[model samples]
Target: MSDTQGKDGLAAATGRFDAALARLDQSLVELTNRVQRIKRIEVDTQRLVQERARLATELDKTSARAKRLDDSAHDVSRRLVVAMETVRAVLAKTE
Candidate 1:
């Protein structure tokens, strides 16, 4: 081949190589950005899981307190009923 033709062929090959390298760089940048986004999502999901666990603990504590209150209320109601019955008996005896 003539020297001129050889030079033109080398230039065309170099241009194609540069274009391929540019496309590869762009793809790498996009892949890096996607990995960053996935990491952020993972962090957000962990935070949400921690929040849900804390709320569940709080709910369990509230439930236990409510149960104690209900038991105390039931005891007080029973005592009141017994006192009323005693007062009625005393009144009947006095009469």
Candidate 2:
């Protein structure tokens, strides 16, 4: 090949190589950014899971407390009815 033709071919090859390298670098940057975003999402998912467990535990405790309160209310109601019945009997005897 002629010297001029060879130099021109070499320059063209170098330009193509440089363009390919730039594209590779851009791809790497985009990949890195995507990986970072995925890591953040994983961290957030773990945090939300912990929060859900804590909320579930709290809900269980609240439900148990509510059940106890309901039982106590029933007990108080039964006692009040018995007291009223005794009062009525005493008032009837006097009448």
> Which pairs clash inside model 1?
none
lDDT of 2 by residue, 14-37 (tens): 999999999999999999999999
What lDDT does candidate 1 reach at residue 12? 99
Candidate 1 per-residue lDDT, tens place, 47-68, comes to: 9999999999999999999999
Model 1: runs farther than 4 Å from truth?
none
Question: After superposing candidate 2, which stretches have Cα over 4 Å from the reference?
Answer: none
What is the TM-score of candidate 1? 0.85
TM per model? 0.85, 0.93
| lDDT values for all models | 1.00, 1.00
